[model samples]
Target: MAQQLILVTGAARCGKSEWAESLAIASDRAVTYIATATVDPADPEWQARIDRHQQRRPATWQTMATVEDLAQQIEGAEPTQCLLIDSLGTWVANLLDRSDVEWEKIAQALLAVLPTSRGTIIMVAEETGWGVVPAYPSGRLFRDRLGMLTRQIGSISSTVYLVTGGHVLNLSQLGQKLDR
Candidate 1:
């Protein structure tokens, strides 16, 4: 199969992770789940969510958890494998403390390297632009950053799926018919 770079995005609890996982499994390759969420061993709720994810995947699939160096991880995957980066929002949250310039540098670096990944890549990201403007500064910052990053990744993705209520809509398949 040809190398596929897919971006699966939707609102929270919309099954983006499950969709990405299924896609990776269907690829018929050795799947490597690149988890971007930072795990806190003491938090039972966080541990429960992690446990759910762990129990859902096949035994043959491998998982790598990291808060940074995502591009390098994708680059390191074998050509015969499939790499699934579940949720870009948490990844951005992990780097929110950096100055605007620093964050730009990091985001640009990941964007630059993503297209060069050797294996099939499926990335899960949250679509938060439709919601109300965040009341706090950090919330607003996160919303804006995730929106910008999603657009950048979508531009490079071979396919972009907008998942809503467990249904996925292929944005590209809609066709670019402008109402001008």
Candidate 2:
């Protein structure tokens, strides 16, 4: 099968993870789930989210918790593995909180992995630009950063899907929607 890089984008609670997982399964390749979520014991909600995700994923899929150094991890993984990076928003947030790396630097690092890595890539990113402006500086920064990352990845992705109400719409068909 031809190697494919897919980008799945949607708002929080919009089934981005589920859709990404489904695509990984359909790829018929050795799947590697790159989970960016960190388990925060202090926050019950986070713990619950982690548990739900764990329960939803198949036991046969290999899970890697690379909350940091995602680019390096992806680059180092076996070329034949089908890589699914769930939620670019969380990954960016983790990096921003951990280091002084600029957004472009991070994007470059992520973009570089697909060329040399021997695997199909399925990236998940939250679509946050449609909502009202965030009240806080960090929130605003996150929205902007995620927007940039989404566009960057989407440009290179062979397929891009936007999930809403558990249904997926091919983003490449947006402009052609009226023609159909």
Please, what is the TM-score per model?
0.94, 0.89
1-180 per-residue lDDT for model 1 (tens digits):
568789999998989989888898889999999899888988999889988988999989888987878878887877898999987999999988989999999898899878887899999999986968999999999999999899888888888888998798888787452332
lDDT (Cα, tens digit) per residue for candidate 2, span 16-56: 89999988888888888899988888999889988998899
Candidate 1 achieves a global lDDT of 0.88
Cα error of candidate 1 at position 39, Å = 1.3
Clashes of each: 0, 1
| Count of clashing pairs, candidate 2 | 1
Clashing pairs in 2: 79-118
